[model samples]
Target: MKAKMEHKEKKIKKVWRNMNIGFKSDLHEI
Candidate 1:
């Protein structure tokens, strides 16, 4: 159970990282 939760957290972190990167790039475009 703990391992599954950790895995989920890692996936969430990756998604957030990608979103942040995209947002930064969008701002640069503007």
Candidate 2:
């Protein structure tokens, strides 16, 4: 169970990072 939770946390972090990058690019287009 612990391992599963850790894997999910990593996935969430990766997705959040991608979202942050996209957000930055969008801001630059303004």
Candidate 3:
């Protein structure tokens, strides 16, 4: 159970990082 939660957190972290990069790039382009 603990391992499953850690796996989910890692997936979420990767998604969040990608979103942050996209947002920053869009702002810079504007």
Candidate 2 differs from the real structure by a C-alpha RMSD in angstroms, to one decimal, of 0.3
Best by TM-score: 1
- Give the 10-residue window scoring lowest on summed lDDT in candidate 3: 1-10
Q: Predictions ranked by TM-score, top down?
A: 1, 2, 3
What is the per-residue lDDT of model 1 for residues 1-30, given as tens digits with 9 covering 90 to 100? 999999999999999999999999999999
Question: In candidate 2, what are the lDDT values of residues 1-30, reduced to their tens digit?
Answer: 999999999999999999999999999999
TM-score of each predicted structure versus truth: 0.97, 0.96, 0.93
Please give the lDDT score at residue 15 for candidate 2. Answer: 100
Clashing pairs in 2: none
Candidate 1 segments whose C-alpha is farther than 4 A from its true place? none
Q: What tens-digit string does per-residue lDDT give for candidate 3 at 1-30?
A: 999999999999999999999999999999
CA error at residue 20 for candidate 2, angstroms? 0.2
List the pairs of residues colliding in candidate 3.
none
Model 3 misplacement above 4 A: none
